[model samples]
Target chain A: MAGINEAKYMLGESVRMLKSGKVSNLISVIIMGFSLLVLVIYILVTLNVSIIIEKGMEEMCVYVYLEDGVNNSITEDIREKLLEIESVRRVVFVSKDKALEKFREQLGKNSDILEELGANPLPDAFRIQMKPESNASVAMEKIAQAATGWKGVDDVRYGKKWVEKGEKLVKGFYMTGLALGLIVFLSVIFVISNTVRLSILSRRESVEIMKLVGATNMYIQVPFIIEGAIQGIVSSLLAMALLWGVCSFAGRYLPGLGFFRFEGVIGFIILCAFLGSIGSFVAIRKFLKR
Target chain B: MLVYEIMPGEKRIIAGVYHLSKVLGRHFALQDINFQLANGEFVFLVGPSGAGKSTLLRMMYMDDIPDSGQVIMGAHVSTMMKRRNIPRLRRRIGIVFQDFRLIEDRNVFENVALAMKVAGIGITEIKHEMTNILTRVGLYHKRYEFPGALSGGEQQRVAIARAVANKPAVLLADEPTGNLDPMVTRGILELLFKINSGGTAVLMATHDVELVKSFGQRIIYLQDGKIVKDKEMLFRGNLRESISNSRVDHRAKKFTEHSIGEDYDGKRGR
Candidate 1:
C-alpha cells in the first residue's frame, strides 16, 4: 500500500515538474524529437534503397548457348531439363535462324553480313529467367551441371563476377546500414540521458528535502522517470508526424521516386515509440542511480 | 475508562547512544560519547564551535550513522535497522536544522502538509491537520506564501510546524534559533516548550546558555566531543534566583530586539 501511494505521489510530482515550464524540459524534448527524427529518416531511406536494389537485381537474365549439329530432340530435352530446376522461372528457346534474325534487327543495315554467313552461323540458345530470390552461386552451379556433357552444348554463359560483386555490395550495405542505425540510436540515448541528468541535478534540493521528510528512494525517483517518459512519448509523436509529412509530400511531387512504401511505416512508428519510452526509462534510471 | 498505571520507577529511555564515534576521513567529528534521553524530557545540548553538537543531533535523527558503537532508539538498535526501516525510524523523530531546510518550491501549507504526505496520510486528514499546525505556528495567514517570502522567524516557525505536524515522539533541533532575533528566539523556544509540555521529547542544541539557563529543564554540556557536565534543574536554586533578579531585565531584553548572532557569540564566548 505504501509503495502504491509513493508511486502515485511521484507521478504527480513528475507531472508538476514538467508543467513548471522550465527551460531544461523544453530543450530536452526538442533534442529528443530531433534525434529520433534523424533515426527514422535514416531507416526509411536505407529500407527503400535496399528494395530498389533488389528489384534491379531481379531484372538481370542469363543466356545459355547451344552447339551446332545438335539434334532437335536433344535440344528439346535440355530445354525440358532446364525448366525442371526451381530457379528457372522461364526459358525461351531461340532457334539459330531466329538468332540470326535478332542479330540483323540489332545491326539494322548489317543484314548483308548475316546473308553472307549463308547458314545461320549463330547457334540456338536458351534465355533463362531465374527466380529473383534464387541463390546466385547455387543457380549458376545447377545450370552448369545441367548443360555439361550434353550433346551440342558449347558453353554456359552468365556475368558471374557482376552477380558476386552485386551480392557482396548488397550485404555490405545491410551491415553498414545496421551499424549506422545502432550508432544513431545510441547517440540519441546519450543526449537524452544527459538532458535528464541535468534536470535531476537542478532538482536535487527538492529530492533531499523529500528524503528528509521520510520519502523513500522510490518516491524521489518516480517523478524524474515519469518526466523522462513524457519527453520520450511526445518527441516520438513529433518525429512520426514529421516523417509522415515528408513521405506524403515526396509521394505527391516526386513521381520517379516510387521507392517509399507504407507497409513498414506502421512498424517504424511502433519502433519509434518503443525507442522513446525505453530511452526515457534508461535515461531516468541512470540519472537517479547517480 | 479505567486507566491502569504502573508504580513510579526509573525514567524510560527513548534514545541511548553508547560510546558513539563518527570519523570523516582523518578528522574525528564525534568520538567516545555516551548519552541517553528519556521519554517526555526536554534537554538542551550546549557547546562551543566544533564541539560536535550538530553531529550529535544528526546521529539522533539517523542522518549520519555513527562509525562505531550502538545507538538505540525505543526498542530498535540503529545499526541493526535496515535501510528500508530508516525512514520509518525518521518519521518518529523530527529534525529542525539551523538552515530551516524548508522546501522553497512549496507554500507554507504544502511545506507543512508534506510531513503527513510522506507518512502516507489521507489528503483530507492532511488538510485538517496541516491547517491546525499552521495556525498553531502563528502563520495561518501566510499559508499560501512561499518560504522565500517569509521572514526568518516565520520560516523557522514553518520548519517547526513541519517538524511537529506528524506528532513525532522526539524532536531534535540543531540551533533552531541561530538565525532569528532574540525576541523570535524566545517565541520559538516557547513554542518548543509548549510542544514538550504536550508530552513530546525535545533535544535542542545551542550555544545560548542564557536561553538554556532560562528555560532548559535539563542541560547537557559538551566540549571537544565529550560531555563536560550534565545538570538537572527543576527551576530551583540559581534558576529561581536568576529568574527573579532578571524579571525586569528579561522584559527589557524581550522588547529590545537584539541580534541572535551577537547573543550566540556572547553565550559561546562565556
Candidate 2:
C-alpha cells in the first residue's frame, strides 16, 4: 500500500517539474527544431535534383530510319518487335512520302530541289518513345537484332551517348543525395545529444537531491525524456514549416525547375516528423544513461 | 501510553555496520570503522572537520558502498543488496544534511512531500501528511514558499520536516543545527528529541560541545577517524566534569559566530 502511493507521488513530482519550466524543456525544443530544419532542407534538395534527372531522360526519345525499298511487312514487324520490349512505350511509322513532305516543309525554297531530284530518295523512319527508366543502349541492341537481315533497311539512328550520360547523371545524384542525407542525420543526432547532455550537466545538483530523497532512477529520468520528446516534436514542426515555405516559393517562381513530385514532398514531410521524434528519444536515452 | 512503545532497556538493534572500509579512487574516505544503532536511542557523534562523519553516515544510508565489511540494516545486509533494494532501505532511514539540501525549485510543502512521494505514498495522503509535518515544524504558514526565500533556521526546519515526514525508523542528521543561532539550535534539538521520544532512533553529528554537554543522552566521540569514547548519562553530574577536563583542546574560543555571509563563503570554499 505504501509503495504504490510513493510511486504515484514520485510520478506526480516529475510531472510538476516538467510543467514548472524548471527542466530546460525550452532549450531542448529549440535545439531539436534547428536540427530538423537542416535535415529537411538536405532531404528536399536531394529529392528535387533526382526528379530533374529522371524527367530529362523521359523527354528525350530515339529515332531510327529505314533504307529505301524496305519491305512493308518487315518494317511493320520491326515496329511490333520494338513495342514488345518493356522499355519501349510506343513506336510510330513514318512513310517515305511523308518524310519527303516533312523535309519540304523544313525548307520553304527546297521544293525546287526536291522536284529536280524527280524521285523521293528520303527513307521512312520509326520514332521510339521509351519509359523513363529504360536503358536506351539495350533497347537499341534489341532493335538492331530485330531489323537484321531485313531487305532495304538502311540504318538505325539512336542517341547512345546522350542516354548513357543522362543515366550516369541520375545515378550520381541518387548516390550523392544518399550520402549527404546520412551525414546530416548523424550531425543532427550529435547536436541534439550534446544539447541534452549540457542541460543534464547544468541540473546535476537537482538530480542528486532527487536521488537522495529515494527517487528511483526512472523518476529522475522522466522529465529529461519528456523534454527531449517535446523538443523533437516542436523542432520537427518548425522544419516541416520551413520546408513547406521553400517548396511553395520554388513552385511559384522556378516554374521549369524539375523537383520532387508533390506526393513525394508530402511523404518527406511526414518522414521528417517521425525522424525528429525518434532522434530526440535516442538523444535523451543516451544522455540519461550517463 | 505512547502511540508506539519501544521497551525500556530492551535495546532494539535495528542496524549495524561492521569493520567497514571504503576507498574512493585514490582516497581512503572511511577505514575499518564499526558502529551499531538501536531503536529509540539518541546518540551524538562529535568530531573535528575531516573526521569522516558524513562518509560514515553515507554508508549507513547505502548511498556509498564499502569496499569491505558488512552493513546490516534491520534484516538485510547492504553490501550484498541490489541497487533497487537501496531505496527501500533509505525509506526506513531518513538523512538530513547541514546544507539543507532542499530542492530549490520546489516550495516547502512540496519539498516535504517529496520524501513520501519517493516512498510511493498516495497524493491525498501526501498532502495530509506533509501539512501535518510542516505544522509540527511550525512552518505550515510558509508551506508554499520556496526554500531560497526562507532564512537559514527556517530552511533547516524544513529539512527536518522532510526527514521525519515518512516516520522513518532511524534519523541521521549531519550537524542539523550547525549554522543556526542558539535559540534556533535549542528549538531544532527539541524537535529532534520529540521525534526520538516518539520511537525513531536519532543519530546527530555536531561540533557544538556545549550543546552536547547540556543535552546529550548518550555520546559517541570520534577522534582521528576512531571512536574515542562512548558513554551514557542518566544525569549531567559526570558529563560536566568530562566536558571541563576534556583531552581535546580548543584553540579557538567562544565558537565564533560566523555570519550568514561567512557561512556561504566557507561552504563554497569547501
TM-score of each: 0.79, 0.81
DockQ of 2: 0.41
lDDT per residue for candidate 1 within A1-290, as digits (tens), equals: 45555555666777778877467777877877888788888877887788788776776567778887788898898889889988888899988888878889999986677677766678889888778788875687678777776777788887888878888898899999999999998897787767666776787777777777787666666666566667777777677778778877887875545433565555655665565556556655564444
Q: Against the true two-chain complex, what DockQ does each candidate achieve? A: 0.40, 0.41
In terms of docking quality, how is candidate 2 classified? acceptable
Quick one: best TM-score, which candidate? 2
Q: Looking at candidate 2, what is the lDDT of residue B202?
A: 81
Best by DockQ: 2
Task: Give the per-residue lDDT of model 1 (tens digit) for B1-270.
Answer: 122221222134567789999887787788888877765567899998788999887777677789998787654466766565556656556889899999888899888887777777777888878768888889999999999999999999999998988776678899999998999899999998777655556889998888788764788898888888888643434333332332322222321222123222322110
Per-candidate clash tally:
1, 9
DockQ of 1: 0.40
**Where does candidate 2 chain A have its weakest 10-residue lDDT segment?**
A1-10
